[model samples]
Target: MIISCYNEEHTILQVIDEVSAVLPQAHIAVFDNNSTDSSKSLVLGRIQMLANSANIDGGGGTYQSFIESSAPESKNKVPKTQDFAAKINVESKRAESKRLDSASLDSPANDTTLFNATSITPTSINPASIIPTSINSVSTIMPNGGRLSLFSTTTQGKGAVIADAFALLDADIYVMIDGDTQYDTAFLPQALAHFCQNQLDMLNIARATINDSVHRKGHSFGNKLLSTAAAIFFGKNFGDMLSGYRIFSRAFVKSFPAQSKGFEIETELSVFALQQNLRVDEIEAPYKSRPEGSFSKLHTFRDGFRILFMIFQLLFTERPLLVFGFLSVLSFAVSLIIGVDIFMEFLETSRVARFPTLFVCVGLGVIGVVLGVAGMLAHLVVKGSKEARRMAYLNHKKIL
Candidate 1:
């Protein structure tokens, strides 16, 4: 289980506890992006309490080092520049060899190191022992002998955190949920069961709010509009294109090229699945309002435009033929409309008039032809890219 957290101090612990109770067999890793509140300390304290209860050697040392680590230095650090094209080429090379290492991809090479312990003993810790208590009294357990790892990086945004976690944690079945206790964890088991039973590559938990007050009106409207746009552009009706809670098979997680740096990540995820024609499904889950102190990180206007732009970007990249073809048709239509009157006049008079308009019409015609040819060529390239991505996805064994 991978939880992406920021300053979710009021509800992060509760989310951890709820996940622990539901998916005890799953190893929970919380990727904190330099939270300013007590979120980091709270997670570290929980780790320490679990370490003590499990009696795992070196666990205490790991916990202490985590506390003393320089996570503070990362609090104000700017996110690294993401050269997506270069990264995609590198990933393609790695994928060709079918040996993509998540740990090495987009790692905080120069940033301050946070908690990096990966090999802690898996011990059963009681969930009830660590509920809303002081750090010393917290006694959370790692269920089903699964270890709990906390990773802190300077990279900002939920998308960056998730990208880091996907690369850092190795799991057969990965579950990603927000730290903001808005989505009910009770739906986890059902979602997991469906994902595994159907052997899906990705399963999205579409938000079904209990009431209209659960989410902001603007957010709700934006989600619908974005989802509708994605459905039309991608030809997939993903009920909630911006849903944060999702499940992924190893293949999907390892093969995904996470490029979004903010709330647009969800949009990227949905489009990727659609472009690849991966086995995916969605189930409606109850969505609740955030805790009083916990706030939403999403900016309605800013992120909405970002996501909308991402959709068009993906369309141009993944379905270049469709985008260019539409433009080509528009170009041809305009050229014919303008040239029709000019051609009729020339034929009737047997003389050239409005040469500039005729030139414009001819130029548009040529551009239309060029765009059409370009679309076809780009379509071929996109097909090849899709095949390569599919091969990379197939290299990983499915959970079933």
Candidate 2:
């Protein structure tokens, strides 16, 4: 199981504990983006607590070594528990001061932070470079003999962190859930059961809120609009396309080309599954409001527009004929509307009165024809690309 976290301090620990309860035997990896809150300290504390328990149960390793094993490349060892606690206290005070100072600045009503794709370069680190060389290695072992790894991505967006995790983690079945603790972890076993039983490539956990107020009006409307748009474009209805919780088979994960750098990654995921005609399923899961201190990072309008743009992009790339053909028809219709009267006048009078209008109409006609031909040719190229990707998807062994 993989959890993507930012500044979710209020509920991160609870989320971790819930996941641990649900999947005690499974390795739980938490990938953290640079969080200003005490979230990192809280996670580190949990790791220490777990490390202590492991030592008591005859699992041989210290908390310090476990931290080092998670990131073998780092030169500095984490400070011991007491020193770490002191550092966290000092840092928290400084963060509070900074927050107060910035509170006076005008900010968007609901947006915590606007995602800037170009700000952070995509991560280049390979999975092999970070994962423990051997699962059985003493330094890497966790409580109950399952690995609990904590990693921080230098890249900023949720999509970037997830992309990095997809590259770094190797698992037969991958479970992705947000760190906000809004979705119930109770449905995990059932979701996993359904995924494996049907041998699905992707199983989306669609959000079904218990309370209407829990679902923001703007976000709810945006999700419905985007979901409908995706269904129309891709010919598949996954119900809730923006839901953060999902399960994936190794075949799907390994084959997915994750290119989106923001919230629109969900759109890309759905489009990929549709384009490949992969076996997919969806199960309704209870969604709730965030804890009081925790805020949402999603900007309804900004992210909604981004997701909409990504859908059109996928449509153009995957179904060039549909897009270009529609434009071709539209162009021809306009040209005929403008030139009809002029053509009739020329026919009756046997003379040209509006040569410029005629030329403009002719230019539009030519453009229409060119677009029609381009669509046909581009459709062929897209078809070949799809075939190549399908071959790559087939190369991976399917989950039994």
Candidate 3:
């Protein structure tokens, strides 16, 4: 099962086509958010919420066997520099060999690949790349702004909506891709097989390749900066923090707590796995710029700031001591910078020249120091509680 949120026409069409070709048995779904373009025609229809009906309820959610579950929802990329081309070539070989068609495809040295799939095309091929197979979460939106219900997707964001869609369909394996078509569809089989073989909870296709362009300065720079910050803040080794290509198993989707409303949905999903130490996997894949008609929706300063703030928000919420302690360091840096300025002033004029600067610096420094110490104590308490919970979880799982 595959779920997608599409805001553009050309990209959405290409994305639908590509996945259908690679994973023929996989279910495809899309949630359109009142797009102004012909993006509707490109997609078969819109996805909606499950209705309280006799057939839908009695048939036991026909999708339930394939997807994760029904849900009350809210809402919820690419590639490397050119020099990484050689690495892609190498990975391509490994991937072909690493293709897992069933319950096998372990780590390395043992995987399966059928020769007939050799004609699989990359997303950059053209608009006519792949074709649509089957549709599950179907919807229809009249141009006048009201949704004329054809089928219920019952989704808000891309991730949450699709998660529910897959659950409704009862799909064992679920895939996610950007509506923009930047994430290569050729890797679908590889990711799918990887999930099946390892029985992994999730597999994300990190944008590991791209043909760089300077058309969208704000989005490009924001993405790069965020990627760098995420590496440091979350200790993730991913090159692209916002890569859209991902795959997951029934277990992960069933238990997935998808609570994000926008692009941040990806961050929420990735971090949840990393933070919880779940069975998550990463694969490098080709990336590309969207077609000309589609507009880039990234805001470097605004969105980047929002994402950065979200990281801190999650960090502080999850690890308060770390957040407070880090703030204390900044507070100390301010004091030191001000202290140096004061000394320099004294050296030049042989007297204290900046009483305001000294006062402000010293005040902040003392407050920061106080908060830092308090945060340390708080962290110890939090840590102990977390340890207890972890032990309980482990014991319950019979792992302890």
Global CA lDDT computed for model 2? 0.70
The per-residue C-alpha lDDT of model 1 at residue 283 equals 95
TM-score of 3: 0.57
Q: Is candidate 2 or 3 superior in lDDT?
A: 2
Q: 1-400, model 1: which lDDT tens digit per residue?
A: 7788899899989998898777654567778888999998888777766654444333222121122232333432321212000000112221232211112112232334332222221222222121110111111224233445567767788889888777765556778899998988999989988988999989999999998888899998999999999998888898888999999888998889888888899999988998898899999999998878778888999989988998989989999999999999999999999999998998899887899998999999999999999999999999998888899898985556
Top-lDDT candidate index: 1
Writing each residue's lDDT as its tens digit, candidate 2 over 147-248 gives: 456677778888897787677665667888889999899888888889879999899999999999887799999999999999988898878999889998
Q: Per-residue error at 363 for model 2, in Å?
A: 1.0
User: lDDT, candidate 3, residue 219?
Assistant: 66
lDDT for model 3 comes to 0.51
lDDT of candidates 1 onward, in order: 0.71, 0.70, 0.51
Off by over 4 Å in 3: 41-171, 214-218, 254-256, 328-400
How many clashes in each candidate?
A: 2, 0, 29
TM of each candidate vs. truth: 0.80, 0.80, 0.57
